[model samples]
Target: AQSVTQPDIHITVSEGASLELRCNYSYGATPYLFWYVQSPGQGLQLLLKYFSGDTLVQGIKGFEAEFKRSQSSFNLRKPSVHWSDAAEYFCAVGVREGFKTIFGAGTRLFVKA
Candidate 1:
């Protein structure tokens, strides 16, 4: 079975500090990986995604991620985080057909001023 895992339940970081959110996935083959953010009651927004090509991918809101096929991990990173970055981050894996996506439990990010 395919699944996504976010080891961190919550993370607190000071404004302007760098942030890294870990994500791991288990699948029979390399699947489409994604990073999404949900702010409060808002819908999940795509931060970044990896399907093929370069392992490093840039995303919205100063976010970036690197996909490691060996480790089956796709970690999200930010050089500088803002207070507005506080939100729930989810790591997901999906298939090209039907676009069925499975999301991780999610990691809540807390930004401190």
Candidate 2:
């Protein structure tokens, strides 16, 4: 069974502070990992993905993640977060099948001025 766990149910960051979101997973073999962000009423947007090759993966909207196989973790980071970055973020794992994807509960980001 594959699963994704986001330790923090929610995270709060200052408008210009650096941010990091944690994600851990349990999978049998090499798993396809991804990070998605959902703004207020919008659908999920692909923030980044790690399908192998490099441990460090970069995505849209000034986001990047590093995959640590030994730790079974893929954490997202941003050097400086903007207020517009506040939203729900989900970490997920999928097989080559593409249909069997498991997503974490999600971490809602709140940016404070």
Top-TM-score candidate index: 1
- Candidate 2: worst-modelled 10 consecutive residues by lDDT: 94-103
lDDT of 1 by residue, 5-106 (tens): 999999999999999999999888778999999999999999999999999999999999999999999999999999999999999999655778999999
- Model 2 residue runs over 4 Å out of place are none
- Residue 96 Cα positional deviation in candidate 2, in Å, after optimal superposition: 3.4
- Tens digits of per-residue lDDT, candidate 2, 12-96, equal 9999999999999999899899999998898999999999898999899999999999999999999999999999999999965
Q: How accurate is candidate 1 locally (lDDT)?
A: 0.95
Candidate lDDT (C-alpha), each: 0.95, 0.95
State, as a TM-score between 0 and 1, how close model 1 is to the true structure. Answer: 0.96
